[model samples]
Target: MTATAKPLPAGWTIRLHRVHNLTVLTLHDEHGTDREIGFCPLTPDGPQDLTVSALDTIAHPRLREAAQNVVTSFYDRTAAARHHRDAFDRAVPDCRVLLGHLRARLPGCRADLGTDPNELTVTLTLTATTRAAGPLHALLARWPGHTGHGGSLADGIDQDLDSSGALTAALRQDRATEFLIWYRGQC
Candidate 1:
């Protein structure tokens, strides 16, 4: 895949650039543009190609975490990515359990999980705006399953969780006020 940019929290942007044999990672914002955050030399078949960590490069803890997620998306060779993909494969069944739980407790709530064809993005759509946020927070908090974190969503999904335990990044798409499953666990 070619170089791409993904939206970050607070109107920031993370850009991944693949130039020749090196992967250039940068963070962009209105105040500062294209600040180098991380870089990895491309080695298609080598063991160290995607295993490099940016902890030493990035000083800020929060920004480092965000940058790591973006950097990890550029590679699927890591064990974490493998674990994420495995869990993603079982999203349907896991979501079904969540759906059942939601409906059982909230009888009139309208909720469903929709997975994109590429399996990179899954939408947890709560159609009832009046009662969506509150119940969702409770349900998700009590959900008896593993939760994916950091770059587990992979690809381009945002990791920003709102006060209601919903992903605010999901609001960028569809324009509907819906909560998204920010961290999904294989149950």
Candidate 2:
């Protein structure tokens, strides 16, 4: 039987492209190939930023450590992609666990979970608004998870917990805010 092309998943798009002499799967966009969500080769120039972004949202230190363990373990694109996919799978359950924990710990917050192509990465977004000081501080402190040192929410608007936590002005009056956490690895 001839193998047919698999269709894109709901809410995801995939395209094939050649970059730096390597065949890469450009996921989630059909256009100019900027903002890639996944890659094959794991090259120094191949979407490492997005990969790191995905890893940073992992709440479990062990899962993060496991990803670190495999960073140098693969020699080729296929192997590395597999490794990455594995890590992403490991992190998915943990992400769900973390979401449950977050939902339990913080009232009035909403959570969403999603994945990139080949299931090599996951993104979790938690949104909440500040009606009082207590919930606001709680949201800010829970942010960035374990690996969110450089990542920020809403274009760095939430970088400073102290300043951003305070809903003092008209813009802040909206109170609704979102924190996007990404976890990347092989599926």
In the range 1-187, model 1's lDDT, one tens digit per residue, is 1234333435555554456665555755546565335664652332222222333344434434546655455343234445544564454335555556656666545665454434334444553333555654455445332133651432333434455544322312221112224323312
Supply candidate 2's per-residue lDDT for 42.
Answer: 30
What RMSD does each model have against the real structure?
15.5, 16.4
Candidate 2 RMSD to the correct structure: 16.4
lDDT (CA) for every model shown? 0.43, 0.39
Candidate 2 C-alpha error for residue 142, in Å: 6.0
The list of candidate 1 runs beyond 4 A from truth reads: 1-87, 116-120, 131-133, 138-187
Window of ten residues with lowest summed lDDT in model 2: 168-177
Residue pairs clashing, model 1: 146-185
Best by lDDT: 1
Candidate 2 backbone clash number: 9
Worst 10 residues of 1 by lDDT: 171-180
lDDT score of model 2? Answer: 0.39
